[model samples]
Target: MPKLTSQQQYNIEQVAATMAIEDMPLTERAYKHLVQQATGEKTADQIAEEIKKEYQNG
Candidate 1:
């Protein structure tokens, strides 16, 4: 949605490269969230509703 600065782009690339061979929890979390936003069909309201349900259930 927004443009990454050159340094930010390089940092992501570096994290991705490390993730290719091993587990990087924070990076993995960030990557999963990024991919979810990139491909998701749900709106922010929908996601928030889901979270609300989860919290209510728990």
Candidate 2:
């Protein structure tokens, strides 16, 4: 994995903290996807399209 900037790290930490407080169960794949979105490696539209494709394929 590539090194994340401070802002990306902070973003991910915030998400983790919120999930912890909410008692949410985050899978490793979900965590990685969140990191990708948080870091701007994937845009919301892109993610939505991927989800659409996955749903359609399945």
Candidate 3:
């Protein structure tokens, strides 16, 4: 994965902190994957489908 800028890294860290307190929290690694998917070339629909497939299989 490409390196994130300082601001980007800080933003993701903040998001990670927020999600940590949620009822169903994702690991930091999972949040990193999410950031990657959101910034990647695929359309939103494609990303959504990928998440859905993973959820079903998981």
User: Which candidate leads in lDDT?
Assistant: 2
TM-score ranking from best candidate downward: 2, 3, 1
lDDT of 3 by residue, 1-58 (tens): 6666787677777777787767557775567576675456455577678879989999
Clash count, candidate 3: 0
**Count of clashes, each model:** 0, 0, 0
The whole-model lDDT of each prediction reads: 0.60, 0.81, 0.70
Q: lDDT for model 2, please.
A: 0.81
What is the alpha-carbon lDDT of model 1 when measured against the actual structure? 0.60
* Residue pairs in collision within model 1: none
Best by TM-score: 2
User: For candidate 3, what is the lDDT?
Assistant: 0.70
RMSD of each: 7.0, 1.6, 3.0
Per-prediction TM-score: 0.41, 0.73, 0.58
Model 2 — TM-score against the truth? 0.73
lDDT of 1 at 47: 61
Residues 1-58, candidate 1, lDDT per residue (tens digit)? 4455676566667767777768654455466444444445445566667768989999
In candidate 3 the C-alpha lDDT for residue 21 amounts to 68
